[model samples]
Target: MTFQNEEMRYEQLFRVTAKFHSTMDIDAVLEEVIHTLQDVYPSFSYTLFLAHDNTNHNVIPIKEIQHNVNGENPAVMQAFVTGFVQIEDRIAEKQSVLYAPLKGRQGIYGVLQINAHNAIIFPKSEIQFIELLANTAGNAFENAQLYQQSKQLIADLQLINDTSHRLNSNLRLTETMTFMSSQIKNSFGAMEVGFFMYSKDSLEVLLGSTPFFENGEGEEFVTFSLRKILKEKEPLFISDLHSDATFQNAIYRSMMSVPMVQGNEIIGVAIVLHESPYYFSFDKFKLLQSLIHHSSLAISNSILREELEKLVITDYLTKLYSRNHLEDMVQLSMETDAYGTFILVDIDDFKGINDTYGHQVGDEAIVQIANLIKDNIRDDDIGARWGGEELAIYLPRVDMQTGYAIAERLVERVATYSNPKITISCGIATWNKENKETFQSLFHRADNALYRAKQSGKNQVIASENRVC
Candidate 1:
């Protein structure tokens, strides 16, 4: 037939091919394929059968195809109208059923069978037409498969990228690793997740339920593990803690461990747990590696911060409590109503001594005073440099009378032991019940009394009460 006689052939263009290519629209492709067959050869009846067998990779079936050209023919609707099959040998011998292997040169995709009413649609030319349809249909099916593969790959890539972003945004080690665990579980349906760190002393990373030390059956083991991370430097993991039949009782299946390591030492571990197989893929492993590396950096910073925090609260000069530390303690005392005696001691005529013998002697004087008083005070007492020559002490559980007695002893000790003519005067105050006083009031009253002692005789203990000469 020439183009003039076959002018309707233009209508057979593959619109169903377009539907197959659309992402997440697999149903659209199937419906369109059956609909297309109905449009062509309106003589018999139709139904589309897709292969569910793995013989030819389940090549979709285009079958039982019918068309109503005259409208008097009721549509033939039977199950076995058409089918596609995978036969071992390729042959062409047929009088009852027509079979065309859905094939390309590479391999047989499947088969397509065309059935019709008796011999009304089974002529030699109609057989030729069915073969032609199968050939073109092969290309369409391949396109659909390719579309599905591409869509899945794109989704996986997007998920991996999103996991990366979420892990990077936070530097908190625990939170970051936990986030990775959740992502892996959601993406791959893994069960259970945890992080573990290795130790050089302990050597191996214990997984699942066996406690390495005593008191570790429940809370103690978790505490011991995390405490080890805090106390030492090491990295480790125990993947498959529940697998291998050894840890099945613990309910652990599979696991992955990433260590937060710094240089030669390991800080901690990031762990993921599962109770099933295939918990992780190559993508999951790579994600864990990246996550662990980031974890190491963040954990290192946390360690450094803790050290710096300690230093910030300590005085470098006298190795005593810094002003900031003292302030915090006072605030805590204020809030808790912790009863304590606050003694403020000042070197009498310390500036005159500095002017006479120089700052070196002044420094020596302060040191001598600190040693003498600290040695005499209770071990639980808090001694701090209230500023330059002034020193303060917090004696917990001591009342004003007891503080006054201790202050007298300090004044006696400092005055008698000094090489120079310099002497120290002290003042004492306790937590005030009437005022519901904070450390601020106690400190202020002590300061006032110390000044009075200095003014009265410059070498005696003058507490906040009648002067004890």
Candidate 2:
């Protein structure tokens, strides 16, 4: 080693060092190391290897790193071995080389190999210079890794915050699950992911995986195993299923199943998959856990909100759709396909029944009437108590004729079964292709028809058009 040797490369080394320190992109820094060293010592081909963050389940391979050649050239790579050994591998065949173990003050990150032309003499100062440069490279690599980890931490925190915000704003379980599933899939880079919930009896599984199923994977073994897990009440992970005797035909190979829990009860499980043989790592596991935990909370809150909404929209005494619920459903349904029949009914002399039998028997009659209408109508038909004595029904895809027929049946049933032999008048109005029929107009028309039925005689059904007739 001599001043001439150290000074030979100082000019290019200065530029490369400055670029390395300037860059926060770790990948660029590693490439800069290779490119700069190649300029000074082009005698033998070279390679740079770097890694950090060995304390956790993460691979902190040096960023921005490159070898003059690819991984194929074992002979050239073999030449980079010398007496200095924290690790050993020949760098190139014909040349004596130096392998410097890069480390911060704490511990080793990785080894860097610099191969010169042949057996060349090195003085103390040049050796000292290589040590100093290696120290810098090691430190830069560590700092870059820590910075990246910090960035990822920020992203996770933001995700939690964003999801919490959505819990208040979205109010729909499907939408929230979709957002959450995307976060998990993108965070872990899985080929596929699913969430499945089971009934308390543990016989049925509900697919709430990705909001909606865009693929058939959820309908397959993913659903079956989720049911099994809920029955057993546990968390399970499967590395590869290809070799397994039980589930060989269901999935191709690698998969993971994690229980999604809220409190002591296991509500569901999160299933993740990858095509490769070895994809699950500690980082992957940790990320999956965090994602599932947040998802479970989101899912639970959404469900509770839904139940509250249901409670708000239902009449406790009669179990019919309450006025508030009817309005919401009517508006939403109107916004889409406004084509339907509207039926309005008024209990004939209902004050007489309430005054005679007391409110309890009146309440029971309302419940029975509601039961009759619900039992006869399609699930698409929405039946609601518009107010104390008026009931409204919106029948999707049913015209005025069918609506009047149904109304006649309901009126007759009430007339025959009333405790005091009460009667009712009903009206039906339906939407045609006519451009003039709004939801309000339909309701008004139906109301007028009911008035007609009341005037004609009680216990009769009339269509809006029939009112004028």
Candidate 3:
């Protein structure tokens, strides 16, 4: 009968060993280990502890046990430290304990402990079986850890590649900023995301998912963080803002500020904030650095594109529209208006001013007159530099009387407002359906009128005669 009982025990041990070897999942293996030990010793209490840096007292419990061992058991620590089995049988107290070290070929990983209500001694065969179980479970845990690390690395790489592809898709600057803000907020699970353009002169923020922070107490925290980042010109990761003496008044718990730099000059900052302290990980901070580096190139390109477009349509000296842009505006105005007025202005005796005060002062006089023209026109009206000493204005939906009044006002403003007491000669012409005039015809008539103004007397207004088809 004793031989039969030993055979049955060996069979059970063999089946439990098969369960350990079949799975590489650590949690599943731990569950199987707990059940197998209970089946073998039904009257014994069991506890499984995973090794944390090889310290028995600071181990992580694998499963909840009803028979609670409040602190570190001496026998369990002895077996784990020695990499061997420990047994204590106290027959007088009716208690026994067995400690088996869960060891792999590399090293010991944890401890498997058993407590029997009745004093009992484990045989050589049972001790060997428990050691085999520990070794198998240790290898399974190692495999699981390696798999998790590989998956995380893959995910990080994918995030970087995806952000690079999207940010380089020829978006405008405003659209690019908005897209970057949304991506960061969603990816990091942040409470507020803000993109701010920080330059030597100004601070402008484009906020996303921060309605509560737009004009509230949170705004003070956001402003303070941005100023600090700008001054430092380095990345800032605050795990706890409330505890930081530099920002004691700041209410938010945590934040990250990444400077968007181009060739050592920081043009902007990207900020992410959360309501809890220590919310972001180092891995996430590194990912954000990579993302901002990729986005900076796209943002710089967009800014250059905008500046280039402005140069194409604007006159460099006068800061007014070029002749070609003016012609386009006139054409567009003609298409949609019943009556359109055109005014041509020439700075009177401009060459005499240049000859007397030099070209620099003459330039100042021209700039002053251009300012008067710009100030007198509505936003929808067009102002352009036609040529040297020649400027033009286009006003749509205006009658001849209103057009003449505007031209008169410009002549008075230029003569009264310009330094060195300069004045301008103006000519007015109108286009209407009854006259059936083209833009060139209208411009020619206005030119003729300007010649008349110069001929009659300088600093005066002249209106061309209207001709019907």
TM-score of 1: 0.43
Task: Put down candidate 2 lDDT per residue, 1-469, tens digits, no spaces.
Answer: 1134656667766776687678777666566666665555555455555433332212222332224436543323332222133322334543455666555555556566665554444445555666666767767766776688798888877876776677667558777766766776777677676766655665223333643234554565566567667677655556676666766674445666778787887777777777675567656676667767766777877778887887888877667788777766666666677467888878887788889998877777777777777876888788888888778888876766777788888887887776657677888888865554667787788889989888887688889888432
What candidate 3 gets wrong by more than 4 Å, as runs, is 1-149, 197-233, 245-251, 329-343, 371-382, 393-416, 425-469
- What does each candidate score in C-alpha RMSD? 14.0, 7.8, 7.5
Against the true structure, what is each candidate's TM-score?
Answer: 0.43, 0.65, 0.64
Q: lDDT of candidate 2? A: 0.66
- lDDT tens digits by residue: candidate 3, 119-140: 5566677667777766666666
Candidate 3 weakest lDDT stretch, 10 residues? 59-68
Clashes of each: 18, 18, 0
- Per residue, candidate 1 scores C-alpha lDDT tens digits across 184-273 of 567656554444445656532323322322123333234434555556543324445444454556654455555567796665565555
Cand. 2 TM to true fold: 0.65
**Model 1 lDDT, full chain set:** 0.57
User: Lowest-scoring 10 consecutive residues by lDDT in candidate 1?
Assistant: 72-81
Number of the predicted model whose TM-score against the real structure is largest: 2
